[model samples]
Target: MTRAILEPVDADIDPRVLRDIYGQFPSGVAAVCALVDGSPVGMAVSSFTSVSVQPPLVSVCIANTSTTWPVLRAGRRLGVSVLGEAHEEACRRLAARTDDRFRGLDLHVSGNGAVLVDGAPAWLDCSVEAEYPAGDHTVVLLRIAGFRIDPRARPLIFHRSGFRQLVER
Candidate 1:
């Protein structure tokens, strides 16, 4: 089978237009959190992805201007909670610019300072393995140390600038 070949556009792409085009594909949402200075710091990211299995590596791309990433990165370990379909509110709260991101959410703090959100479909305790600058965002490589999964949970999704859930066919 042959793939379609497209011609390149002559004009520069608009960020908003590019984002809208990229949003056509759905992605699962995850909360990246850690206990920093006795406070839980977290953020919702849709760019989380599995990188490798041999080293149990995962990755998340965070904007360079994010204040939360700096705090969360300083921790010895970071908690990656794959938000379930029921966590739409929790996801939004985590993404907010409030003093306390865990205000109304159920969470558990690990001995290593990873803050896991309760009811998440999956949770992973990881350490920052590597980081690289990718344009305006930073690519964070996480080396998973430990993890847990709840097979029954459906993951929360982000699509076209809206929250969504996986559907069973």
Candidate 2:
């Protein structure tokens, strides 16, 4: 089998034209996870953000064609693991469709059994509040149930299809 990168569509053809363009700005990686039956289902993403403060809401988008997103979205509860400098391997593993993405990854469950990935800069255990279709992706809005921030760990970043670190000014 063979594959080739598709040619770019017109400026207004796809709303997600900005998606590939947005890679110019370095973005942090995170794992959006939920428990399916007794096992963990997760997807690595760079498109997550806190959307609200008073209500403590966060959001992430998953491609409509993603097989993992459907399974992970089945539950009412989830955990968002914000990757740290040490979690590059974990990020790569989860982003692929290979066996045992959790292999060799240190993890533990929160009081609610939400998976808190070790060595992350932050973790958010949440209840999925809403989900809506947006172009070719599904935008998930969640209400935070619990959270942890690790000041000792620096957030990992991605830019222009590559993992990167910011230089101090």
For this target, which candidate reaches the highest TM-score against the unseen true structure? 1
Model 1 has an lDDT value of 0.92
Clashes of 2: 0
**1-169 per-residue lDDT for model 2 (tens digits):** 7898887767576645675678788889998877678788888999898899989999998899999977777765788999988888899999999869899888867767677789898999998898999987889898999998988888889988889875678
Question: What CA RMSD would candidate 1 show?
Answer: 1.8
Clash pairs, candidate 2, are none
lDDT of 1 by residue, 82-155 (tens): 99999999888889998867888999989999999999989999999999999989999999999999999889
CA-lDDT, candidates in order: 0.92, 0.85
Candidate 1 stretches with Cα past 4 Å from truth are 1-11
TM-score of each: 0.94, 0.87
How close to the true structure is residue 168 of candidate 1, measured as C-alpha lDDT? 77
Which structure among the candidates has the greatest lDDT? 1
